[model samples]
Target: MRWMQRTWIGSTITLALTMLFLTGCPKRPDVVETVPRPMAPQGEVGMPTPPPLPKVAIPEEKSPTEVAAQPSEAKPTTEAGAVPEAKIAEAEVKPEPSAEGKAAAEPELALKDIYFDYDQSAIREDSKKQLNENIEWLRKNLAGKVTIEGHCDERGSSEYNLALGERRARATRDYLTAAGIGADRISTISFGKERPFALGHDESAWKWNRRAHFTPSAK
Candidate 1:
């Protein structure tokens, strides 16, 4: 009986030990190794890299000779072609008058001297006809001015002849004025008996001396 009790105690002890070992030592779970994913190539996910800028071709600078070689646009011209400067100057120049023009420009024949009666300042009929012809000439040549020279015979005293001569000249001027000639165009001068048409002291010379001469002004 003692042995049986001992064997039973031994079997119980061994079984209890085995159960404790199984419970205390649990089986380990499977271990998984973590690998870090390669970092995405720089700038793939967050901010993307900008593409490179395109290149622009620049033109080369041209030389002076190349620029000059280019054809220039023609200038616009008028319908009437441009006249030469010399030709324009020649056209502006006035041509000299011909010989015929010069001859035509010559002054007309002088008016005939008017004879006055002795000791009289009044104009005679014959003298009036001559004066009218002179007036016509003056009218045609408006630019001409005349001086009337009065003369007297040597019969009177020097002072008296001078007075007579002046009276004669005034009478001639008045006649010209009344005949429509401008007074400003006519001037008077008394020669008295100093200058005579004829040098002789006879009546023929005296008749010629008592005259009014018409002299055109040079100016």
Candidate 2:
């Protein structure tokens, strides 16, 4: 009976130790559930794909009509067939006259005027020489008619001066006619003291005012 009681006590102590160890020790944590990530589809797999092509561009085809319609570039030719640049420049340059041509341009005859003396009663002898030269020019030209315009010194009444001017003009016309100019080719007019060549009442002014002037008129 003692042995059995000892065995029973020992069993009871082991059972109590086991119960204590289980109560004091902590339990391990539970593992959480996880979902796997989806994978990317590969090109060689059951995926849709684009059509394959060559890397280089294909030459476009042209119709025969379009090719024939295009203009061709001009071909370079020799100087014999084409005008030279030097020739073109020469054409653009103007011709310069020779020295002989310039010398020949001098005038043969020139128009000249005559001056009279101060308030003279008649034309002076010096004026006769000038009138002779004028007659020579008239005979040479032979195309134009002449008119003698007589003027008086600004000293007398206008009406009296006008009559005096007319006499002077007629005298000049008679002289021209005697000098071999045709009477039909000459005419006369008179302007009195009312139209003075110079305004000052001086010798110099009177010389300019008392004059018979000649002007050529076309037929």
Per TM-score, the best of the predicted structures is 1
Rate residue 96 of model 1 by lDDT. Answer: 91
How many pairs collide in each candidate, listed in order?
A: 0, 0
Q: What are the per-residue Cα lDDT tens digits for candidate 2 across 1-219?
A: 999999999999999999999989988889888978665555657666656776998899889999999899888776567888888899999687665564335212222234555444466678788778778767876775777777888787898778777777777777778988898888888887877878888777887788777776653
**lDDT of the structure predicted as candidate 2:** 0.73
| Alpha carbon deviation, residue 108, candidate 1 (Å) | 7.2
In the order shown, the candidates' Cα RMSDs to the true structure are 24.7, 14.0
Clashing pairs in 2: none
lDDT per residue (tens digit) for residues 72-139 in model 1: 99987645878877788999997997765753465434455788888998999888888898888789
lDDT of each model, Cα atoms only?
0.86, 0.73
Top candidate on lDDT is 1
TM-score of 2: 0.47
